[model samples]
Target: MTFEFLLAFAMLVVASFGHLGMWIALYNRINATGLKRTTIKRIEKAIVLACGIIPLLLLLIELNQHGLVGVLAGLFGGASAWSWLTIAYSVLAGLLGIVLAPFWIMDRPHFAIARDRYQVTSAEDLNPLKETVKNRRLYLRGRSFRKMSKLPGNQIVSLQRNCKRLKFKNLPNDIEGLRIAHLSDIHLTGQLSNAFYRLATDWIAEQRPDMIILSGDILDNEQSLHQIQPVFDGLNAPLGMYFVLGNHDRRLTDPTMVCRKLCELGWVDLGKEQAMRQHQQTTLRLIGNEQPWFQRNPSPYKFEPGRTSPGNEWTIGVSHSPDQFAWGIENRCQLMLCGHTHGGQIRLPIVGPIVAPSWYGTRYASGVFEKNETLMHVSRGLSGVHPFRWGCLPEVSVLELALL
Candidate 1:
């Protein structure tokens, strides 16, 4: 037989065995997981479907290149080097894409159903659990996890705060009815519609916030900026709509463009900057730092290239994650807002999230934690990549801080 025939035969043999090996690996993976039989079956089917499509499409392409009558000739006939390589790479990449694509693209909306399972007994159940009077400032998180269909929502956590002296001199004494709607962890991909933004804008407007603080993860892509702007345009804030960037936003091709687009629509980009005296009778210093992704450090102020004291201002330092305790402590921020972990989108019973990207595990995965009298409220965030909600449901925080 010709060398070309031998090569084609070898390619076919290797590919066939490789495909079988991959299928066995997939089967083993499904069986190894603690998921139910139905889930395992579904996964198995998905793997088979992916495998089937690749070989079928390649066969069709081969047929097109060489008519049925010339199938054998075409297999052995010399093709251009580039064309041959392209076809070979396409097959390899297509196989890889089929295998990994499920992790990246699976849109199981189980979290929504999971939210229905949770019953809130009281307002306290919805709020973070606090043991001391000092911990009255509750922290609420938005849905930030990309959930699988069967996961539970976020686990409610609580912490105690000790305040020897209450410090916000400029803060309004009548801050009882004062409301600030905190929205964070909006990973707005291009799929995000103008309507979602409208819903969010309207929700905040209905809350009648004296101020709105958007923590971070503004956009999944720079293109998403255009889609989200019209919603922000309608965001009617008497004080101002403030914003900070998250790690995801920093991954965009041009994060500055995303920032500029939001700012153009009346939101202030607070990264490494401050907005003073925006509120009545109060010097509300809004401080925002860049995403930890850029600095290669999760701690906000630890590796910050620029150093400046937030200075005895009644400041609310906005960050994407609670990685920076030093910045919050040194600044003496009365309140800090953050969102990144979607509360591990899929949460097990008491074991919590299967995987939470934060350093503190599931402890600080969601809700309020007080560090050195600084009350930090981490919003779970608005939307995530995966559609599941598990233990944590989607949230919109209406924070009312009654100063001690």
Candidate 2:
């Protein structure tokens, strides 16, 4: 055999052993007691055999040089490993079930609270509803505020060194005093009353922010859009109101039309590939890379961070998830704002978020993270899935970038 063949054989041998090792470990560790010992052993054997077959299959497809024929043969052979395939699928389904099961079990209905802080401000003003909807409306209003009333200020501060201050050089001396209200992931389930959004918008208006940046995941469902549209009409800012798509928003039908509806009311969609310059000086690149359902090899141009005049302009990148931290770092972003994970949705007291989906369970679960020179701010977000926020409270971040 040639040197290339020999090398390929060695790699396949190592891969085969590694795959077998994993199966052996699982067989010894897993509690397969109720099942017949012979059955368990057979399953483990099949897993090991499939693992051993993978490298050979890959080699057949990539190195055999027979092209499609070899690829087809490998794929067919891979699928033929029924025993391992069954177990593998079962494991995947179990993991998925674990992840999504929480949403169903923990769906917070309206009107399930003890505190009066979140009660319906105006019962007469509540939106008209169908018979069933009218009954559920009362329940929804009850859970609106829940434990939030007990929290200090109903606002949680995700304090980190990165949020200390953002450095901007050419932030127009005239606009140097500009303040921005940044909010994201306001998953407006039925539990959140229409009055809450109105109150939030009114409160934001009172702050008199120069600009409003709604990062994404505004409404949780189609019904929420109707309730939210009125509240959005109440929002007003000097510069503009910008928004991007979140993972949840993309899951709905006619997402583009939804974007259009918001845009018709002066809300900028800021799709996957769009940039908006501010004050004719700084550039803001908004990338709407919806999460949990990533596209394969999406064009890099989707988030082209145009070159900014150093010491003359500040470019801020906005995204829904901080999953693209490496991309931001590569492009030399001064600041990136994002929200998702909702500070792990439910956090423990001192131990922090039990499981922050992104960042691999790091305390950087929320707030700002400073790596070298780049600053990434992951907001605690504005609303909770349920009213059970133990440690991490909802928030609206006021970010002031100063020219230093």
Candidate 3:
């Protein structure tokens, strides 16, 4: 192809990518809302159809009105509503966005496995820790999900148990080596078997966490509520088990029922209001925020760092989305636990995670992000509404807190 023709083709490709991204972002915003599954699916279908049809129509119009050379000239000459200048600028913008947002991990700044203050001491992959002694039928069914996800590059069953030792700038000396098991986004839609969660919960007991915190999206449908017990039978946290709700949980027949069930199983309900608990000699102020979904009451947090001292008390914020990162900072939380983006569910090579359901896009899709004095750990989540994952695997974390 001639230089001009090749340039035109490349420009079109970039602009097309940018256009698709715009639509995807729009749908993502809507999906983040606590809308009905059927309604969201309908809107998604419409958006996908529109994205495909619009471009095809534009191409056909250009082809019919202008031949090969004519079409290329029209593309370069600002044909119809899409001006050549505008298209050129959009192409540049798309390229710039692709360079960073997801692919911005090259500096190893936020993407580092070990930050300056924290280091991951042990990372284990536990798909089959052991057989579910109590439930053979359930184990076989849940294992079937693996067979379904055997497609190329699918890491649906690759569960990572990452133990991270984090040292806050103001961590208390007494609380050193305090381990907290962080599990989130267990979207129980019955697609994943109960035996899978059973082993997961069993492993939590093995960790012997001082405190246990589940960061939400626990149940997608009420049908899976029965499995909650069978799956999480032995979740015993010495400090206490605290949890919040996510947008997906709201989709259940009764969101409060899920909270009640988990609470009945010994998990504290942090979703209702701000709570302060004493773990050892340290005071932990847990703030739970489920905004834009089941948020009718005002936040109970004082939103002041002076209210609590890190030496004696540490504030920990629990939310479903990393969009609350700023809120955690405002509340002077020393650490935050969150999981809603599901690590974009399916991360791509170079691009990383692109389709996260967060206001900040995929900025805090997963992993530890530090800002101000608050350090946040966003879990990749054990499961999601979608059945499979790519480069991003499901995660169960043990965050070890210590003094810097």
Candidate 4:
């Protein structure tokens, strides 16, 4: 082929990749956010038609045409389309990051400490849990949106076990070896079964965490609560089990009933509340802040770091969304735990997480981040709205807090 034809072909290839990336980013945003079903469906249809069908038609038209005019037309059209698509994606992404600039900047400008002092001493990946009978029924017969996503069988059953030993300078000496088993986004709907959670809890029990904290999205459908109630009840933690209401949990028909069920199972409902626990001679304060997105009451409780004396107490904040990390820091919390990003549910090798729902995008999407005195750990989460997980795997975080 001539140089002109090669150039035209290369432009078409680049535009196709750009289109795919844009759609993938959009889909990730939909999965991360709790949008209405109708809205999501409409968006999906549009993406398929515009990004998929229209491009194919354009390519076919270009191929059917003849001579230098056709080649030049294809090159110019492809280049123009790619430029517009890139600009649109960048503009939207930039706007989101800009809006959350305050929270992102607040977490910066921290005291520098030795890198070795804060390290992952141990990182272990647990085995995948056996799929339960109920899980099979749900995946095969459930009418959930995930079923319609056309997820692969392996993606549905795959789970990543992340047991990390994180050491930080701000960790208190008394609770220095504290192990907190963090589980989040356990969207226990028809797609996932109680047995999946049973295996997770059993594994956690084996680790013997001092405390167990669930960040949010415990129940997807209110009806499935009965099946998994026993699994959650069976969880054993020395300092007891604490939970915060996630956006999905709030979407339930009777969100209060869900909290009541957990409370009945002996789990503390830490929604918009604070509790203190004494581990040996050390006193630790735990605060659960549920943002007002879907909450019914949306408590007016505020955390004022200046009012409370640091004293000998260590404060830990828990929220369903990592967006609360800034609030936690302002409240003088030494450590914060969160989920809800689901690690973008699909991460690329070099590009990382393309779509994280948080206002700051994927800044605090997953893993550990330390900003000054506050250290936040975001779990990949146990489950997600979509059954398919590409590079991102479902995870149960076993955090071991240590002092420098």
Candidate 5:
């Protein structure tokens, strides 16, 4: 290509990335909001359309105006070659992140699968292929959108029941082997047959967990709130069933009604209340943070970052979003449990989970990450606002906390 052509193309590429990247950053924040579902969805569509057409228009404008050199000069503003080095560096880093990601299974912390992997099907135990065909006809208009979008896949219907043994420095030796069933993002939208969720809880009951933590996003539409009781029939934890509200939960007509229904079912409302438990003579403090949507109430355990509680207290934070992880670490919360991203609900090959509703993008989409004596587990979650999942599957895990 001629030098001028190359410069024009490079300028177009940079401009496209700039616009797309800015929209993506905006989307990540917008998705984290608890705005009206219809309002946010409209914005999402507009942003997606802009991400596609804006670049083509930029190329046309550059060519039509023949102002490539002038624009390029103003774009860089005579910056040093050092500035362009970032483009090369980010390209290399992104490539490595994709290709080397599969091997992350090796880098992952030591955790046993423990036991059980149930192939959860519909209440009738229908074939998965048959279910897919039924889904196509279910909610014709909206269903057609998600199905034709080819965004995520049937993995949403493919429920995975896993029993994992997670090790942590904060897990007291006495409390080691404590089994906690972590459930998140069962977006009861009435789209998926209730049977799918019931089967998931059946597996949980078999695990016989000491505690059950419902991380968040339990309801997308308030109409589905009624299913909570029937679906969670067999689930019970001696330490108790605790939950925090997620952003989607706030979108409901009455978020408090959701909390009230769960409390009626004997679950603890950790979203607004504090609870402490005693196990094997050790103190376990449970803290709930539902920021960016629901506000956090005053509690001794809630402190500013860099401030900490006594080391002996095992503070486990239950949040809907993983963003509060840094807050958990700062307050000496040894373990933080979250589920909001739904494991990106659509992870691309190599690139991993590209879309997550968080200020941190997809950094902590799901899985266990540890830092400075604190550990956090982000659940892949069992469902989503849209019943689509590509490479990722819905998860219901029994986390056996073990001492490091």
Candidate 6:
């Protein structure tokens, strides 16, 4: 082959990487935007079409010309255009943000008041208890999408249970030794069977947590709501089963219906609300913020540590997205729980998740993060819009509180 041909091939490979990065960034922005579902869907379709058609057209043009100039120009031009457009968009967005900065009000920081500061004692990884469920029925739309994307259909249906033991020092004596079983993003739909959720709930029950909190994404669609109600009804907790709606939950045919069903099943619908629970002599405040994509409430509630009666009062924040971690810090919440990123649904070693659908990127992608006197835990989530998971495994977090 000629030197010119080799150079053209090299440029094509580099251009492919550039195009992939650009599209991924754009998709992430689309998810973070507060656009209507229909609007977002249309934009997504347009992106796919543009990405596919442009590359194909360039290839066809080069093939027809059978000339080095045509091949080189087509590949290099596409790459340069992608790079320039990305730069231009970034610059424009930054300028607009600066212009709008004056209108934005900064939230005041709220510091946690602890009788004694808490420190981590032990953190150990727990293996998942694997269970396989078989179903022959084909969910045409979902199955075809998975097949086209090369996502493992079997892995999506399989259930894996994991436990996390968290110990905190200086935990209030009254509320110390509190065990919470946290689960999130159980996207029950045509892809995941009800039996899988049943098995998960059973395992969670076995842990016997003092409180059970489901961060969000309970149902993929309204049809699965009734089917999964019985399974959720079976969950037993002294403080009761509590839940906050995720983005998908709000998209149901009737969002109110899902909330009503959860209430009927004896679960506390904590969506955008706060509740206080007393166990023994201790008092704990639970705050739930749904914060759907289109309707994000910046400050759901202002928590003041000094405003509460002293002694044994602890506050915990629950939301669908870990993006609320900042809010938790500003509200003096001791702990915040969430699970919307789905741990990117696929993680890579060392580099971590390539694409986490969050405004903050992979900063709070999964696991735990500590800022000031507050702690936040983001679950990998039990299920997702897509069934397949790669390096990231599904989990049920069992956080046990302890005193130093």
Maximum-lDDT candidate: 3
- lDDT by residue (101-213, candidate 1, tens digit) is 35322322232122321222213222222344332222222233212221333332221111111223234654434566778776676433454445456666776777788
- CA RMSD per model (angstroms): 16.3, 17.3, 4.5, 6.2, 7.7, 7.4
Q: What is the C-alpha lDDT of each candidate?
A: 0.57, 0.54, 0.76, 0.68, 0.71, 0.66
lDDT of 5 by residue, 1-404 (tens): 45655654565465445555567766877887767668888999998997777555654554455455654553454322223333453354445445444544442222211112122222222224345666544423245333643443456566677776677654567788888888999888876666777767887788789999998888877788888888887678889889988887877888988898899888998878889998877888898888877766636475556655554567788888888888888667777889998888787777577667887777778887777776788889987767567777778888877755
1-404 in candidate 2: lDDT tens per residue?
45644653444444444454344335433311224445655876776676567545645535445356554443344322223443353345445445533542342211111122111112111222223445334324544454353354333212111112344544556556566677887766656666555545666677777777787777666766776676677687767777776655654665665677778888766554455556655555444444433332223333246754454444455667766566656655666777865776566554455444453333345666555445677776766555555566566655666555
Clashes of 1: 19
Range of the 10 consecutive residues with the lowest summed lDDT in candidate 6: 104-113
| Model 6 RMSD in angstroms | 7.4
Q: After superposition, how far is residue 357 of candidate 6 from its true place, in Å?
A: 2.0
TM-score of each: 0.55, 0.56, 0.84, 0.74, 0.76, 0.75
- Compute the lDDT of residue 162 as modeled in candidate 2: 12
Candidate 4, 1-404: lDDT as tens digits: 56765864654454455566556556645644556656767887886687667556554554555344554654555332333544354355455545544543342212222244345554554323333545455333245633543454334455665566667654557788888999998887766656666657777888889999998888878777885576676677889888888877755777777788888877887884577899877788888877734554334334464565345677778888887878788767777889998887677776566566665566667877777678788888877767576677677877888766
Q: Which stretches in model 6 have alpha-carbon errors above 4 Å?
A: 1-15, 57-154, 167-169, 294-301, 304-311
Off by over 4 Å in 2: 1-175, 280-288, 291-309
Report model 6's TM-score to 2 decimal places: 0.75
Best by TM-score: 3
**Alpha-carbon error at 168 in model 3, in Å?**
0.7
For candidate 2, which ten residues in a row score worst on lDDT? 116-125
Provide the global lDDT of candidate 2 against the true structure. Answer: 0.54
